[model samples]
Target chain A: MSAARHDGPGTGGDAPTPAPHTDDQPAVPGTGEWRRLSPRTLLVHCGWLGAPLGSLALTALATGGRITAGAWITLAAIAAAFAVVTAAGLVRWARTDFRVTAESLDVRSGLLTRRLRSVPLHRIRTVDLTASPLHRLLGVTVLRAGTAGSGEGSGELSLEALPVVEGERLRGELLARAAAEAVAEDPVLARINWRWLRYAPLTFWVVGGVFVAGGSAYRALHEMGIEPWKLGFVRRAFEEFGNGMLWLTLPAALLAVIALGSVGALVLYVENWWSYRLEWADAGTLRVHRGLLTTRSVTIERARLRGVVLREPLLLRAGGGATVRAVAGGLGNKEENRKRSGLLPPAPRREAVRVAGGTLRTPFPDPEVTGRQIDGDRHLVRHPRAALRRRRTRGLLFAVLPVSALLAGLGAAFTPVLLHAAWIYAVLATPAVLWLARDAYRNLGHQIVGEHLVVRAGTFSRDTLVLRREAVAAWTFTTSPFTRRAGLVTLTAAVAAGEEGYRVPDLAQGAAAGFAATAAPGILDEFLTRPVGHGDRTPST
Target chain B: MSEHAAPLLRPPRHRVDPRARAWWRVQALLTLSGPMLLTALVMAALSVLFFPGALPWLGPLLLVVLVLPAVAYLVVMPRMRYAVHAWELGERAVYAAGGWFWQKRRIAPLSRVQTVDTVRGPIQRRYGLATVTVTTASTAGDIKIAGLSDADAEALSRRIGEVAQDVPGDAA
Candidate 1:
């Protein structure tokens, strides 16, 4: 393929101008023709090779001796592997080229066998730009284009490294073309507020991060042929901390772990959401730009957004804080779903609601007011008391009593210590289970207000989904033998956004049917028209 | 019956074609007979090879246990499924209701349907039967109404396609 270079001062131009290709090309300029990735990609690729070499050097220092012949051979092998990998990356960079035409974005790559991906401009749903610290140091960023399709692998196209300015211009041009309507200038919806960091530790990420760190450390020690518990320092530390009070020490150690986890959560939150900003870009799209060490910029068109989900984890809810997530299609692949779904980090519940109202304006338009008016907690219809009884019985039978009986049976069969402990465990665990069941029951609610169908449920992580009633494609009503006896049915509204369907479980059967019929008019009418088993037949045409 | 909201009781009223019961039995027999026959043969071989002198009656007893279930499944269940399987193409939606134990009632709006296809297997072809599948944007909204006559299946597919096309907006 012929490479056409654009000759000009690359910066300060509104549109990229085509330049003449020199016989001895020095620097590549921005143009509509196929262009290679920034050469700094080689440096980024080489950084991956540094870990093994650094570890080897550390091992030599720790041993404090002359390297063995085997060590020399391994070193040589590592060097050879690095060289091979670096050469591959270099060839890949050289081969990779992309062009943004008026209608589509074309990317051509692959060394041995060529592959060209052309994504039409209309189908381009999201253009995301990300830059790690190393990339930022090299003045380059990674750009990804997400298209509307199923399957995680084929939905997105990415260019690994491009000069930061070119990446920005490309993103602007693609978004401008994708949204035909003239976009209004940037109108800020939300920005970083340091006070929101308190909600960071409220997430399960803190506990999960601690567990991951501990697991990784144990794995590292195991790989080195060391039993971590057998280490003298560890044993001494545990003994000294315990001070002959094992129960107290257990709680103390847990507190220490939680404290460390909280710190880690804070650091991670700062890194990921340092400069978080949500704004309406031009006229018809929303843009989210955030991150400290690895910055990210995501732009999504207004038309693709279906609804909004306001999430409140148990702890965050207790503090009156919530997070906002967009229920939009064509934003990202399934793998990036969780990251791309987020619209606002944990903030005051009111702020989250306000931001959600702003983001969902296009989908749920209200003429009387500047901001969309969504139903608040007062409008929610709580499930009946029988639903609470169902949840309580479920929790008692499934979670609490089974474990208690097993422990008690084991204690009676074998150990006296466990026999006394069993009663305490049962008593303590029963209350916790009951409390959670009550919390879940309290959280269960569904409401249809204006043009939206709002459903809220969950104990640990409450989600209030505000979906446009018009978007609902189907309704599924399911009942089990027990649920039928209790006069309850589970109703699910199938939509094309996040989760594909949202279920409101254990509603009074009549109420659920009425709700389903009302939410999507006439869809559920035939089922309600006549009782089943009438032996009636509507003959095929 | 007094006018009241219908209780979430039984499956829907519209049943599939009556001939479906016979077709299902034949299909089940064709699909399951090979595995059942192979199992009996394997037991016979094992009796001869591994436990040559042990209880000869044990082999026959085991064979009875295995073949009895297969016989019942191939003979009885299909008829029950045929009784339960029902579908209705309503003015605005396609309703499908059925399942042996866990009865499912699904209503997919015509506006959401993306594709409709009529399929006929080899056995179905011989029996002049076909199945029509309705696919919608939501994966769970997919519906299959099987055991229709070939003519009915084609008609239903075309009707669904027409209805889906007539709807103005795409599913969210």
Candidate 2:
């Protein structure tokens, strides 16, 4: 390992040097020495016991140093379990070793079975270096190398608890193909903007976070055998709150909830994106570095990036802000993808578009030059009127009828008050539902821009996806019985990245086949027949 | 189907084997049997508990209610699916159109195909039918052409596998 450190000769500081460990990469192309993880990996593996021990200590302190016989038994069991886990960890650590060759990364592990898993270097698409607080405390980090063909479960190789510097060096070495052009100063694509914090509260977490926190806290208390509602202070607080004037207290409670949620959202925003930065690290890698407590740094190979999604939740859009997510491959499984794909936090819509454009390497027409309209506002072909009718009908059927009918039925069975409330609710909700449908319909559009197929849809979270035309792997044209009658089809472009499919819903049937044929030229050619000398026109049957 | 100027995705070149309709019916019947039996038992218990006097009339009515939808599904779904399902293996792409209510036509380029598999359920095996699934790199783009004769399915899978092997790139 010491030899590994001094393997490369020092390069001029001003020059854009290859990775510090690049010289070592080709020195021994096929054969490389296997190395074990940091010895502190044992300590990190045993860190799970800290929770039970900490809880026991807390109990002992709270109970005035009294330890029941059961507690003693539990403590003994914990100690025995800890010993077994530590011994197992040691054996596992001793058995497992990984090595990086010029062509591939190979891991050999298992005490009995003896397994060797080799992932080629070219297929490795992303490298994620994550450190929890305990890992940081132990001066180690966990590195996850995601391969291009890897899907949900088996596509990633993880090295647990490596020394921080070693993990960084390994990440650089693994993705060092185009590292020669890496400048001394990497270009910052985007950085955390304080003004964007205002958009944090506009998220669903403003209201949902309060309930989630309360629910989790209540569950935790219940798990500990304490009934929160039965507590004297809790009961008293509720009684006092109920005693206040109805309207005033209701509004005050609502205000308090909003204030608490806003504060929570702000704290979460600050903690999660404390040092958030999106940058072009090397010629072919994009890097995202953020987090305050448990820090994360993820590097995505540029070739694996399929596209960018500009996301605007209804509330966020109303506040003139949006977020950007990378539609990149090998981010990990679905859950990992969600956590790792964020390229920008909620920022001004203009800034989000700029980031998206920068990521895609195609500058969007400037708003000022494009008659003060956003990218989404131009060159988009709207869906037929039937699509709007479909949305309106669905909204009324699924959203309004269910709630109102349930309320009306309950009222009929029990009380007249709910009957009146049902009608009032219906009256209040119908317009809102209709408006949302109209907005969603208006937003439904698609365009085949140069080198990209742009599709914009969704009302709750309007996503304008700019997918690389070359990235599309397949096409799916779907039509329900209703859609068939209305002569509409939903076209989905299936790429390997992001959501796997981006849909242009409720396009006229003729338009859909034409769009698919035009977007990915060769795939649909057999199925489509255009009129002679009418290439400019939409395809005809 | 229509004499219009507008271009639509015409049906693929082939329909599934005719015995597929019968196999589908059997599959549907097998799927519905347990639920129908459970519903019948529940109704019987309800009648005994609270409506013993009305069981004579209510029992038959409940039977009709449960059997009606089951019968419709057993009859209509298979036929509708048979009518809708068509597939083709083009020189460069595999095409499949399927589903009764939500008709879908999928096209995957041979170059992008990751795997080709032929699966046979017990009922399908009894009917000598197999399903050929052509999976592409994209999760949403797998093309399944069901209800082919066993030999046809094997040939299809082998063909896809051979062609995909020759066409190379990381499918993504």
Candidate 3:
């Protein structure tokens, strides 16, 4: 890619030189000079017309391939809508113009209001270039520049449908300020490992995605005035399945769903992680380049990197696989942050740890060194026994009781069958609930591992966060009435990057202050009456 | 073990203005009781229109479930908050602790302080009260000192703003 040439100096192609613009005669209503989005943006915007037109065609086909008077009217309305949309898209494209000045990147848009958003070049912490199949076909990509210190809504500057080369150049230009002098010979940290494909089925998407897709399909059919239950083929299929022995059909149906879901998961994995590469581009920017159909290249400034999170979902952990995410600033809002922060796909746990260590620039202690996994659970300080009791109480109170009560209540009001089901459910679920509670309690642990504070918590998706102590902006100690009585408190380490506040839940009351004091010194020192070091580190049994 | 039994964190040195108690009460009454009263009235009217026979028990149930808690909250919360809510600005950090049943103590270092703002709503204006919001780069670390006298709020914000101006970084 020509993007690499931007770092190599002298190999400039169509890259816009950041020569100071000294135009005194600024004529175009506002700003010094502005460049409009690609003309093909109008085409991208008009792509929505295809969906409605396709639906119309399907309706005509379903109705014996003859267009009725209403259908003709609908077609005319669609054409009018298409024309209006095209005009709107054209106006939007014309209005939306962006320019990279010496100090800042400015984007101007809107018809009447003429909104202008300018972000300082220094604060531009990440630049993302994304192109969908349609966008690729049109030879354009969307560029989003995320700025530092701006919270939530107003941090990100986006220019849709910039020509592919221009988008790459813009990305290079935006991040050029932070480009390091040392040209990295081997920038590649990790690449797509085909063996990791076995971990695909372990994701929540495997089973949950099937139901979600089914729901979406059902909703789509319903919206199109088709009742799936009332369909002849669907009903016939269900009848055939029902005709088989109940025991046999139930297992077969489950197997079929599992098979379908596995296929879906494999396909999704391939699409999302095809040719995935994590690299240090120019030694200053960490770049994640991935995706098959919708190619994404997210470049994050090394200075903005707070830490790395090693995520192990239950099934993934069971399968010995984990994922890694960047805890960096200027990844945009919550949704954008999640989408952009993924550093590694579901791969071997050891590989994830290695990637995490590489990303942090500090090698995490290998299992060989400590006879344990990377920043393993053994070294971490476990929460008090009261934490376990609290979890057990919560499980019984919230999960088990509510479900059983609802069933039992319905039985009292309506049927004896529900009453039987309630007891059966309680009997079946009690062990599972207890087991989950135990697992959650076991997962809860925190430790100060040199410069990084490692916190491992959560039951379903165990996230072991390795955060820099220096990145901690503030410290918050919270205690509920119950928690206070139990002699425990939850301490949250607030940072600017990733999730913002990571909680170290249910520490012994006295130990909480000591923990926070140790994790990030000076913040809590003035407030503590006694010296924090003198405080007891309550040993967890 | 003995140290573990002691307070986890000391209460901040300064308490909010005494009038804050009254302000919080009125604030609570307006926010909690007002909507609850309206909901109760609507429920009563619905019961009277649709199921008049159920009004005898439903009226009392609504009062117990909805109205009583709101009334209790309006009366008790202000006093509890007045006792709990305290703040102290150190040279390095802003310390604030508040909440009744679920207490929270927050510390935001001056170095990381991004923006300092003072807000006064219509009700707060009537009560001559203001809230000093010290926003850090982290969304979770925004320290808000509510129920402060207007003058105090202004002075606090100015102090924070001045200190933040001197201590420089991206605050990220």
Compared with the true structure, all predictions reach lDDT values of: 0.74, 0.82, 0.81
Cα error, candidate 2, residue A442 (Å): 1.2
Top TM-score model? 2
lDDT of 1 by residue, A1-541 (tens): 2223223344564323112223322233443567777888889887766666766675577557567686688799988988898989989988899987767889999998999999987778788888888898888889988876523548688899887777776776566554334445337889999988998888646767899999998987564345789989999987897676889888877888899899998888898888899987745678888899998888777766778888999888898999989877666554576787788988888888888888876432211111122234235677777888998899889887877788888899999777777788778878888899998987787777677877888988988888888778788877676887888888888766566777888887757767787777767676664445543455433
**lDDT tens string, model 1, B51-148?**
88754786767567767777887777677677667877777788876654455678888878888888988878878888888877665567788888
Candidate 2's C-alpha lDDT? 0.82
Tens-place lDDT per residue, model 3, A1-541, is: 1123123343355433222223322111212346778888889987878877887777777767877787788889998998899989888877887776767788899999999898988788888889988898898989888888647867888899787776766676666666455643566889999999999999856667788889999987766556889989999999988887989999888888888899999998999999899988866788898999999888888878989999999999899999999998888877888998999999999999999998988876322112122334237776788988999899888888999999999999999999999999999888888998898888887777778888888888888888898999999989888998999999898888878888888988877887788778878777775645454422211
Total colliding residue pairs, candidate 2: 4
lDDT of 2 by residue, A218-337 (tens): 886664445889999999999998887888998888899999999999898888888899988876788899988788888888888989888999999999999999999888877999
What digit string (tens of lDDT, one per residue) describes model 2 on residues B70-155? 77888899999988888877888888989998989999899899888899999999999999988877888889999988888888
Which numbered prediction scores highest in DockQ against the true structure? Answer: 2
Can you list each candidate's DockQ? 0.29, 0.45, 0.44
Off-target runs (Cα >4 Å) in candidate 2 are A1-31, A182-186, A365-377, A530-541, B1-6, B41-52, B60-64, B166-170
- In model 3, the runs with Cα more than 4 Å from the true position are A1-34, A183-185, A365-378, A531-541, B1-8, B35-63
Residue A154 of model 1 has an lDDT of 80
